[model samples]
Target: MTSPYNNKENITDKSSDVVWHNATVTSEQRAEQKKQKPVVLWFTGLSGSGKSTVANAVEAKLMALGKHSYLLDGDNVRHGLNKDLGFSDADRIENIRRIGEVAKLFVDSGSIVLTAFISPFISDRQQVRDLLEHDQFLEVFIDTPLEVCESRDPKGLYKKARSGEIKNFTGISSDYEAPLNPEIHVKTAEFSIEQCAEQIVDALIERKYFSF
Candidate 1:
């Protein structure tokens, strides 16, 4: 049952094992082309709290400004890389962990990464923050009040969660741990989606995370 390729006894040494090499297109080159430095905008909040809304708007704005960027929406990612994960606490943590690693890689590739997820646990959010440099990781807490999120209920999830149809729902069956000191906290209850995107862009500019 052995494969024909295994009969050759192929072996790899230390030199080949280490694939580290200088980038042909450096970060500086990317910055110059995009007119901005790349970073990971880690958006954390409860479902129906406008995390994805704001993240999408921010990415669109960045694109209009000629910046390279991409968004890692929770629902979208779950359908792909994290398809097997469920809504349990442990699954939530692992989901954030995988997304964080992927976002960090996107940042390293000289592209701004916008991640929108209901990362309810402060610890899980902090774990994602620890994956990047101070200027590279921007923790944006979409502080939408429970009442506001419930009222919005864009996806009807809040109603299902409250009716006991859904389990481990953040801000409902599950607890949401607010960030102690996030880089940017958008109180969505009081601000429009455009306002939230502007606030995030202002923070990025203030931090000098973008050259222009």
Candidate 2:
């Protein structure tokens, strides 16, 4: 069959050389055999919106429930995989791109992965969501207002941004698009960390991401 495009010469079939492996013996298969579904919980919001806090706490809760999980925080990922990237719009997109691939790998490994990133741009966040299967991706918005985030300013980023020391800071120098239809919205402004974490966990439970 030919593609419906004019670039017929560009089409190449490499399907014959593909090899099959019985990775069915891996932990992913084992978990799925146990009827456990791996999920990517993406936390997006402004700085100091308690994204990292809630993600870490959620991971702890999942751990306590005897489930596999991991957390990918913005700062932590930057310290390693994305160390060379700056805060420019291009770098920000690339940063999220790398995280999206990593998160996909984690999901394939049968582990619930939580990502904590400002992910200010709606397009960038949508790109990440597009990498996963339906019901496998959960977008959680840490809906904390800018005023609250600035006041908390746990990392002093707000001060740097305000003083013109930092460039492309979300909610300070850059823009943050609120999620329109997130699977979970934790109003961090009105809730404690524990409460927020519990809310997220409950959503996961309701979604049946795990057996227990």
Cα lDDT, all candidates = 0.86, 0.88
Residue by residue across 145-176, what tens digits does model 2's lDDT show? 89999999998999999999998888978888
Query: Which tens-of-lDDT digit does each residue in 84-183 have in candidate 1?
Result: 8999999999899999999887887788899999888988888887888777888899998889889999889999998999999989899999888988
Could you estimate the TM-score for every candidate? Answer: 0.86, 0.87
- Candidate 1 clashing pairs, residues 3+ apart or interchain: none
Best by lDDT: 2
lDDT score, candidate 1, position 20: 72
After superposition of all CA atoms, the RMSD between model 1 and the true structure is 5.4
**Which numbered prediction scores highest in TM-score against the true structure?**
2
The parts of candidate 2 lying over 4 Å away from their true place are 1-28, 33-35
